[model samples]
Target chain A: MNIEQINIKKSIQIYDELTKGRIINRHIYSSSTHSLIDNPLFQELRENLDIYTNQYQMSGHELIDDGEYFYLIYKKLESSTNQLIKTKVYSAIIVLVRCVTHLQARLYESIKNVNYGIEIKEINEIELPEEYLLILEKAKLGTLDKAVEYLADRSFLIKTNRDKYVLSNAGLSIVDEIVERQNG
Target chain B: MINYKSTIKYIVDYDEPFASLVEYMDQHSVTRVPVVFFELQVKQLIDKITKGTDRQIIDAISKAYALRNLKQHNFVTHDESNESIALTKFIEMFVRNMSEKMRVKPITDKRFKAHASQLTNILNEANSYVSKTTNDKANFREYLQDFLSEVKQDFESNKRAITLRTDNLSKLLKSSEAHGDQRLIYTKIVELCERYVEPFFQFISHTQDKNGFIPTMVRLREFFAEQEMLDEEAEVGRFILNFSSYTKDIQHVYDRINDYRRKGQQDLIVFNGFEKAFNHLSEIVMGMQDGLLVRNDLHNNQDFIESYKRFDNIKADNEKHGNVSINYTDLIEHFKNIEKDLVFSSRRSSQNSPLTQEINLERLALDKESASLLRARNQKNKQLILKISKLIKLHFSSFTKLEEPMDIIGDIHKILSAHMDDYRPFFTLYAYTNIRKKLLAIEKQGRIRVCVGYDQRKTFAYNGISYKYRPILIQDLT
Candidate 1:
């Protein structure tokens, strides 16, 4: 597909946001940004995903469209980037595991359903094991607030309220990988 | 004659004390309270009203005794012990009716069958008097009326008992307190299912058996309808109307029980799934901690640095291939490396960088030794898997010859015990998954049948980690 077939300006805006390491999920962002999933540019990108993939590939990033969200990963992982990724993965695992064991939530339901959005207070109230705390501290997600902030910044979690969060599709994708690994 | 008005007034004026006493008796399932205890409680209340002297306490006690003796009040009676105050039937029933606590009185199967037999006897006696004189007909009507009233009371009590029990069970299952103690929750669920739910279902199931509660009720309704048709009496019509209402109430109760059963089954599934996830996560975390401890003991800072150097070399080699996509396994490896860096870096000064750190000869030698030990462990795991797989294959062949369904875990455990000294459930699960995969492939052809018994779960523990899986049955068709 020709890149010019799509709206050049809107496509560039999406590319610019992806390059900044922000995942564009189906959920609407703040007043400054629109939900890409609902945008016409997203429809065009879906139609011409290869075009966008090649576009991002030129900038040392791989565009990943996980059905409900779009994100980019570094092709050649730098040490700092690898460290960031590790921290995110660890924090996600910690949060999700606590959500299941502490709150009695199903793994998929907690991730997929909005009604099952986790309350920050409830997650904070769960007394994690010493080992888990140590890992979370190492990851700089020692507090639930900091973890929420970090994850929200990356669009892994969408804040439904001041104290509630639902997993974005990007977050679910990471958990899906973990679950697949666990099953294997 | 005792003054009924003043006696009621006294009881009402001391309602708090009376209510407390009644509640205590109800909870303890006792009809009597010690006179000393009752006086002590009343004395406390009297003291609260005024700084009561001994004389005032005695006067209060005298008033209580007078009220107990009043035939109109019928609140309490003196037991043979005379040291205790026994509650009269009136007050006992009154307090029970007013109290919020619904104590579920479970009706045993024997009791239920007895009730059914009594109903059948009443039906036969009523039938025998149908053609007799006016007096006999009147006796028949009276008998039927008494039976109807008794059955109605029984139905109400049964409905309340089952409803309250189910609600309590549901609350317990959902309660956070019960979530922590899964064994307790499981026990309660089993109790609810066996002691209450299963029996209630059996009693109500009209289709499965002709002698169930519903069928018996249907027969009673038919008798009442037949009598109403033959006699053309308003009383018989009332009986028919009453039975119809009872049917509606029974339907409501049945719907509630059905809903509760469905929710209970769902709760069980969710509970099991969460338990499995929790166990799996716990196992992984424990394994990670164990691995970290072992590595920490075996490898020093310099060994870690050398390993990182090797890792960097591998990374560089991968980079040469142009744009490598990282998977979960690679991400986990990277995370482990980061963890190691954090562990060792803390011991060193916060300011000192990895590049500036000097490598010692002894630590370099330890790194190579650690590398060789990891390789040996991997090799041992592989050998164990191969041995387990072979034993499983041998067992499956024997089972095929015998034409019997295999108890996968049980039979495999026996085979492993007879053949190998070293056995782990983890290795067995790995081998089982492999065998299952192979059988599934072969099952695609019309040569064999593979069935996973989801209802039957087999569990085994190794090194304090529990593994649960469904049994798989394979049958050779050709």
Candidate 2:
């Protein structure tokens, strides 16, 4: 293949990553994964993803530039076969994030500006719904551990320590999307 | 028998008019009918619902019964007419309670009786203030200061008592599942609820002069009774809401006290921010008596009062992002609600200072840790699909049927399903289309010659059984 052809291939590879619900933070991914932060090929994809893929009919998936990271938001359709998240797991995650935020804001101890990474011990202090009992039991790493890990695995949260995870921008965006769905 | 809230909800659910055609119905109910008798009733319910109920309930009921369907419909339904009749029948009961022998049923839940009586006592004391007939009219500012001091004293004394009781009650609620003590949990819930719910009467009783405080007190009463109707299982949500609501009040009291002690302007800027929102709401609601009801989402969402409970006494411009970020939609809504204060309910400042504008909004930023996590997930998901696609290719390579397309993918699906047991995220049954879509795109680009075709067919086993499936074939796209 010619150099231009190879660049086009690289762009598709980048598109594939986003299509799977993964976020491409240019600053990090350029260094860690592709080393293509300023590379013409990756930059081309970053700048013009929708233009090339507009013909492919991406099942209502759109490339969203939330200004922090790049990812695909699947506009959820009732009959569309893309079933990525379970409702119970989603609810548990939202509840966990709320608990962490509520505790940090309310408790505000001697330490200031500590990352809102919640330990299972701290997570246990907040009240959650009864239906969550089943979800916790289904979690392989015990309820709280599995709960955080599931979000981390989905790129919704990032594991900071053995006991704590921080919600990612992607996670917050997903939650924002969930709330919009709920509102509509 | 008299759930005043339920009756009002019944009318508003149906009667609130939509766009234009039947818009007169919104006014006609109060102007033309006996429904005006319950004008005070509807106003109280609208307050309780928007400001007092859980966000989940508010969101659910509002969306399910939004004002869209009432465009051409009459304001009152047959059921509401029935409810209106029932409401009139109960006027004597509401009045009789004001006098000695109201003749209501004694609460069967013994847990609530103590707190209920305490509420009655506070009500009696505050009610006497209205009848005091002072020679000189009490200054509103002086009156509020005195009431605050009393409330602060009351809170300080009961802080530990309420904490200890609620702590024990929540523990009982958690353990009730394993211990099978449903009744025990129920009573504890009632007791915990009563401890938090009754103090509002003290505010409502004396704060008749304080703008918007009495209406809030009325909503708290309805919210408390609403809590009473919930079973032990469902009451957990209400239980958390009660604690949140109380803590919000305590936080406000603390902030106001701090402001008063600071002895600066003590302009009651933040306090009156809330006061004005409430004052404005009361004016709009009171206007409903004139049969001029211009409906909108009411002001002073109680959630906002609770949210900035600490910052409420300070200048609005100084409001800042403290420590953590709330990711949910409600947080966004809470910030938007900063507009409802009606104190600085002015045009948005070009600078958008937290103080001068409605919401001191911050754009959520992705941290390095989160960014790295997302990048790693992308690489991993890519690798997963690549490996699964190879396995699928190898399975399809043993294609013996060159005569026509064969139903080979179904058996491949069963094999992939078992092989991808640990691959929960990647290998979903629903993603058969996703996998196929990717494979076809690759084929169209000539990167791979993998073939996928589809057909719905009635199937027959070689021996006896027959079934149907959305059958498909796989081969090299040669």
Candidate 3:
């Protein structure tokens, strides 16, 4: 019922109307109908249906029927379970930033006010997860030599070249500050 | 009443050898026997067989006792010391006294008459043979003279026949000359055969007949067969080998005539009759060239000749007109004129203006109208070519075999006409080359002089060298 939801529903409605009220033919739902369904439009409709939930935008016109549309929505929800982790990771980065800023603010305010008896309690710890070490090791940041290196070693990326790096275990945990805060 | 001694008895009492061998028994003075006389007496005994009688009868009598049945004569069983006497007695009783008049009757039927006639024929034949054999020298001389005379006569007759043959051959040749050079050469060869080779062989045949070396009847039939043109080729061959030497004669005559022709003498001359049939024959032959038939058929019947003469009475009329020339020339000229007139008349229809003529002119106009159709078609073709060229120029492409458009409608006829002209030259050239090549190859392989194309010289190293002419073809424009 917000603008975002309204746009999504209107977009889907337009797509359905352009496709003559059917986004995918009913024939595509059955395994037996796969070979018989050869229209190039069917493939476009399939790709657009994947983007409908994942990217919130369709690439082409498609006329998918009710059953296929419902199944595609169900599959999108199932696949979007990974999106929850991604969302958690993003919120954790914000949380870490907030924790750092809050600590700095406290120090500055106390100093500016010049209060003699102002005492700070211990700042809450933003402990990175133990699994972060595994991610860092797997990334192989030792021999990276590109501006956007995937952090693997290869001959084209000599060790003496301009350096590049992937996040360490601690950095990875700190970058996920906003994600961790959202999850907590 | 026939006495026993004369009863058709075979005489054995005077058997010399037996008598001589036993004669010593009768003599008191015993002389040693002469083996020579004994042998001579034995020889004489064997020689005393009856003439004009079957030898079997006499042989049976000589070995009489050996043939006697032992069962029938018991007393005369076997005698060793006097075997000759035994044989003598057996012969005297059984064979010497026999007569057969009572058994078989005398053969006095028509067979006797036949036998008499046969005998007479044999005697006459014998007499003739004897006369021929005994005085054979004189008879042989006479026969030789007669043979020589007959040969001479035959030679004369052959000369006459040969003359006739030559005349006929010459006529044929002359006629063939009128026809074509090839036929003339062939006929001239035949003429030469008639004149020279046939006469000599005819002399040989006549001599063979007269000498009885060849039967007269056979020679006569042979001569008749050779002369009989109606006879089949094989039957004619059975007679005196009819070696025509015609080819040689034809060649000789051809050479002579060719020599004359090369010398540019008159093409034809008078050969027979007062008016000279040669010129007429030549003219007729010329007219009959290329297998044309000529019917000149002069007849001996005066009536027909008289009527023909009347029909042909232009001579006197021409003479009166002071033309004084042979009417035959005029006749030929007139005939030629008629032919020319016919040819000209046929061509006149196209040459003359159809409008001026009595025939339908509308058809001609229609034809001319239709004829413009091709001109329009040609214009359309030219336009199409120009358009296609302009369109194709942008592509920088020239025509290819496939891309070129053809008038498929009349292409078959066009191709036919084109191939007719194109193939003819090649056909002629190829035919000439093939025949020339074959002939030249044959010549090179040892055949002597053979004429070939237009005076080309070729040498053949074979048994004997010969020369031949290579004739040239004259250009004909028609």
Candidate 4:
């Protein structure tokens, strides 16, 4: 199976198992026993929820303890027809990011130019500009066209054809110039 | 007018046969020829070969020859792989015959297929991994490198335009620096600790060390402080204290009023300060009820227990007078009414009050600061309370990860007792029974188990089986 398919399955599993599966009894959670929410394990789980919710087209019950940390249980929006279509779209992004990153790595090696390939791990850490991240977080893989559209506006990359993209000359030049300046 | 070149250096491994085929196609004046060495999309091959070919001659060749081939033979006639070789050979034989014409180039079919497959895998693998691992930063970096490659080859090179503007370059550096900053890491960890750790445990010890107020009182002070109603806090405290005192003082005045009524005496303690004091206590009690409800949404057993104890304590002191002239039940009824009236009401309106208004403003100011010792102590208490409560709850569950069970049993019991609230009797009872049973079971089986129980201490049967009880420690579990 494809990488996108794997992610979709994993996502669905996480959604079904750890998060959506647990029944939240307010009476139990609100009681003295609810102190479980404060555990580091639960806190980590809650942070994971925040990250996922921000990246995918999903929502859940988020309990914030006075803005310090949060507890969230995400439920996939089963009613959204757009979400069903987005499954494929989300899969596409994984495919595209994978492909481009690989291609970039090869090109960088051949040219001995550090500016060529994408820093995939760094990209994940590098908080996307708020406007772009918001779009990406809410986007389904199927609406990758929309993702590309957002990227284009920011001059990150542009789609040359269906399922194909290349860094715009403008974007490429930026990295090239940065490297040149750095080397000097 | 655009010149495009296929990167066909790798195709020479299968070059000889392709050259022969092209010679034949060129001799036949075939255009739009197909290369069928691979059973793939031949159209892309045809487009690749004829990218810069002469339009007029190619157009005529396509109309006359391609159409005729299609009509006459159905052997995938006019297929680009077959005719393209013929066209190439024809061009080589008589180079002068087609001057200023668009020339077509044949790209080896095997080469195209090989590149396409590799590209597909590269794309697909990156796609799959991004979704599975959220925490694996390394994979994300790898995928990004791949993404850049696909983009680099696919676009036209423009040396001048690709250069980064100074601002964007600065942003890139700034962002990279931010990514590596230890402060960001510290902030995140602190945020995690606050969100996850501070809420559960009550740091009452710290409060005693730092400020004299108890955890609950600190919370109350904060609430009043936020309202800019500090004046009300002192008044409220005094008011509550006075009510407790009056519950005692009222007894004497009430008796005087009663005796006077019996004898029909005129000058009684009923007329002035005594009556005002009694009424004032009732008003304060009502105000407190409103304030408490606004601070928390709690309406369960703990709340009930707090109110019940306070009211009974006050009433018992008042009843020391044998006369019991005042109706204590009426005061209780008044307090209960205040709770019922404000049950679900939003406390936003309280912000408008002179008492809350300035306090809210000050809180807003405080929120901008990095950290507060007062807040820290408050959070410590919350964390301690939550930790104790969790330990008591977890005591009933079976220990799964522990290597030694005996030690855990003891540690859990200690945690339970330390944060124990008098109101949650069942929690303590259940915890005690479960811990006892697990210890006994550990000794009997030569193994340890942490068992959940619903208190039937006499039968000692938890989850339908009886077990011996003993204490477990933290080391035993870990």
Candidate 5:
């Protein structure tokens, strides 16, 4: 196949992955995992990034690249779905804070290191305040484990083991932004 | 004769009863112990000390009283009636000094004025001693020493009081219980600063008031320096140094309180922001649950935007990447071909294929005939409705002229029979029953007033079926 055909094939593949709601991170260890930034397909799409972005836009999906990660958002979001996403994000952050506070750990430091795994047992032991628990329950994340699983599914957390999970770079970036805003 | 010193020694040796007594007096801030109450306490103590005979307990009680009344021991003195025993001033001071438990009372303005007056009198006395003899100088030095000691003690106690108060307030402010009520914690901090800490700091550090505690101490230090009494000067210097240190300690506590207040304000702002976001999201969820097509303006709401920005790492500024324009006209056929391929693929995967089905002409003709018949029935029903409406209107027009309440069913039957050459009573009755149902519904909707009564004695027969007759009176309030 010619280079143009190869590029189009790679672009379609990357676009398909993004539309499936999988975050494309800069680093991926295994070649078996084809969605990594280092994949030849990703390199081909990067060479024609603007073309692919415009192509995705024509399809009613906005391609978002924050330098380190890539994701997609619909150009016109349904209001209910948007609100539900916001609620889930807020609930996750609030639960994260409560867990950090219960463990008597610094909020930013706890989430900054990708290798820093929070024990699932310790998270289950945390007794969140009633008000915070109510919010989580309303968002269908009534338990800390469920909230952790939700974040992991969204690529905000990485499940390192059956009982341990570490904050992903995307999650760390969010925490860093929040802390900076609070301190500032 | 009891050796008074040994008696005092004996009282101290039984640390249980005597120590317990001292603690009770200190905590209650009472110097006088009633005789009976004292005996009762001693008896209780003895019972605990030894499960001995009653006589032995009585002896322990007697010894306690004897120790209190010892003339030479002077531990306590009895009143004229001997009903109560008061600790001697010397013993009271000793206990207070030993315990180091000073009552935490903020120094009053009145007391500060008294100190200033006392210092002035001493300074005046020193100034009047012209051609001072050694005896006069000794007396002046003694007086200065006494005044400096008292000032030192007062300052020490005041420092202790401020430390204790601030420490308690700090613990409470940091406690989880206090977090449950942010407003209460805020009020407590404000009250501490306004009522106690600020005032005490001002009273000590008020340089504007020449007779203030700080200025008076400086004046005394200078007075001793003028006399060239090296020892007295050194003592006063040390006093001033101690005073400065105490003020610094209080200032440290004041800074801590300020920090807590600032932190509390920040926490409150954060808490309120989260609460607002949570409430707004909850309202949206509730609206959606109620089947409302709620517009979530959260993305555009300033407060919600601020909250979202805290958690949103992805910046929406996509202008840096150069925009690439595509010619949609050129790709239209290509997109249509891709769409057709997708549709074809999906169709191939299904169990049944739409293209394989054959159309049945016979079924089409039958459907057309049935549709025409249904249309005819609908048209007939519509005409029946119009006739029923006209008859009801006629009945209402002549309502006052008619003697008997209108038999709505009979009237509808009569109208149907007169209007059509061939009319089925069953169908007419069905139409009348439908009219009655509509009228009841209108009444329920509050568009009209209606009263329905059953006349059980009367039966209405339609097609060999009997239904009890019901008469309704409807008032059209509208």
Candidate 6:
């Protein structure tokens, strides 16, 4: 199939989301975006992302699509972006949530879309390593509450209440990426 | 059109046959690159499976990736191992067995499976490709490494795109330097994972027998779970303060019941605050009912003795005061109702209002003195007053000649107190009895006469002699 055969319109829309540093997750987008995803154009773009994105990224940026999401990774490596999660503690929380999501995804086939509310009081129930728990006992600011807020702000997990959270699309994707790497 | 050459090179570097070849070269100190050998193996595997249809090689390779995952995860196809007679024979049998294994319906029934959307449809297609590679063992791993390499490379190199963008996170934190202790914790975990866990199984794909070498990932994760200390739900404490909440409501009901005539019947018509408090108490009793059997039993005999004798006195007095008989059924049911509520809502202490600590030594003494006032709430002595309330009615409800209060107390005291020397001395009830408030409540109702007998003490037969204690009698209003 010729590269010209691909739908230029849908690819551009995906390009817009990716270049803006937004995660182009199908579930989070509008009906138009989702409908476009089902189009043959999107599949062509997904199959040959390097061809389309590289042509478009001649401005010195790169376009990439993981299995479930499409986003841009800056080659220049900006010091700070609005969506950048700065602290290691916050990363730890994301990793923890990722671990749980991976565990559940195995028992389930279509697990990503489902959001099981985990209570805040039940944070200690996730079966983490012993050494990590002892640090948590001493923390005032770096608690699960802090990590949850950081993740929630960026759409990884939704804070349903002061005591419970439901993993969002971004959250599940992060878990998928983490588990793949860890098990790889 | 797909980049099979480089992809095959990547897979061959990491996977079996070619992976073993590369490792073999390293061990033998071969200086020249084995790039040609790797490409030939890749071409040979793809040509064999696709029958010279090069594009279909991608499909075959996709299956190979899934096969590699299954192998790495050590997914078992058969309960027992089948000895391989020949390479072709084993591959054919293995494919047939694995197809059967994959065909089995998922074991657990989920009421609502997550919706299969377009994104997941693609994922499923990919997984199907992976699953189909089960029998592609000979041809699977050759070029499939392209897909794995792409995925693994993307994950390893461009992790930032997949994870949280760190700048957004830095704005909120004081920096690792400010919180040195927390930084230390993060450093240790990251460093250890890199050193131990990440490198633990890097080359296990080349090993045919990994059962003994590769520790199960699940066991490793569990160790990390404990080491990393993820907050688990099971470790949460104190959902509700069970003791204080129970007694606080019980005390409020007791106070309300005390204001009643015949413990609530008279106030059923005349009292203003009666209905609200009565209903609240009923609700409390209803909640307590579920936990009734499990809690410790706590009661004493004084209240039972006084309450029973008072029943006879009310009957005698009613003979003269006209026919204003107390409904024994309602009172008994109420006792059972209240008992149920208190026992079941066993865990309802208000989170905001726990027992306050005494401020000083003086307050401590006062707290002890007034401790009896909150005897039920404090859950001290474990005795329940509702039992006494019910027992008094049960004892007299059976009597044919309970015209006087004296006759009732005599029977109870004879069986319990006067038998200190009897075969089984049965005054266990005498340990802690409380009837002062309940009796006073009855007297204040002006319907029952809870009069203390003139002799404060009476004698009864025991051991062929006499035993003495208090013998109280009741006289109903005439």
lDDT of each: 0.57, 0.41, 0.32, 0.34, 0.58, 0.38
Error of 5 at B23 (Å): 7.8
Judged by DockQ cut-offs, the docking class of candidate 2 is incorrect
* Candidate 1 runs further than 4 Å off: A1-132, A138-143, A160-164, A169-184, B1-13, B21-43, B49-90, B96-147, B150-478
What are the candidates' interface root-mean-square deviations?
A: 9.9, 19.3, 72.1, 34.0, 9.3, 36.6
lDDT of 2 by residue, B1-478 (tens): 2133543454345333121112222335331233344344334445567876677655544433322321112223323543332222233233323333222211222323333344345444444444554532244324434543444444443544444444455556556553224333444444334434334323323443333333333443444354352332233234334444555654454343333223211111222232333333334334333543332211222322232211121111112243112133756765665655433554455343344444333322446567889999999888878867777666654443345554554555555656774444225343455456765675676544553345456353322443345565544444
Error of 6 at B251 (Å): 62
User: B26-72, model 5: which lDDT tens digit per residue?
Assistant: 56868676667666766676667565546754464456446434544
Q: Pick the candidate with the highest TM-score.
A: 1
Q: Write the per-residue lDDT of candidate 4 for residues B1-478, one digit (tens) a residue.
A: 1111111221222223334444545566454444453212233344554777667634433332233342343212344444332233322322322222212321222432343444345434544543556566456545534543433322211111111111232334346433223223333333322332222112212223333223333444444455465663564354334333333332333343233232211111111222232233223333334445442211222322232111111111122343222344765776555544445333443422233221254665677563676778789777755665577556646544565433443354445545555423244455555456556665466444444333422223333545444333422333
Query: Weakest 10 consecutive residues, lDDT, candidate 4 chain B?
Result: B308-317
Per-residue C-alpha lDDT of model 1 across residues A1-184, encoded as one tens digit per residue = 6766777887887876665456776554342442213545457668878988998789666777768777676666544223334344434454554555455534334434555566767766776656555445444455655676667666677776334666676665555544444343
lDDT of 6: 0.38
lDDT of 6 by residue, A1-184 (tens): 3577667787777656444334444344223332112334346567777677766578555555555555455544432112112222224443344333332221111222233355545554556543333323222125555566545544455454234555555556554433333333
Instruction: List DockQ for all candidates.
Output: 0.07, 0.02, 0.00, 0.01, 0.10, 0.01
Give stretches of model 2 more than 4 Å off.
Answer: A1-16, A25-45, A51-69, A73-78, A81-89, A101-114, A120-129, A135-142, A161-163, A175-184, B1-478
True contacts kept of 2: 0.00
lDDT of 5 at B58: 47
lDDT of 1: 0.57
| Candidate 2 chain B lowest-lDDT run of ten | B309-318
Better of 2 and 6 by DockQ: 2
Spell out the clash pairs found in candidate 5. Answer: none
Two-way TM-score contest, 3 vs 4, winner: 4
Clashing pairs in 2: B316-B355, B317-B355
Error of 3 at B411 (Å): 25
Candidate 3 per-residue lDDT, tens place, A1-184, comes to 1334334554555344232211233222123331223333344445455444343224222222332222122222222212221222222222222222232222111211212111212221334333322222222221112211221110111111112222222223323332233233
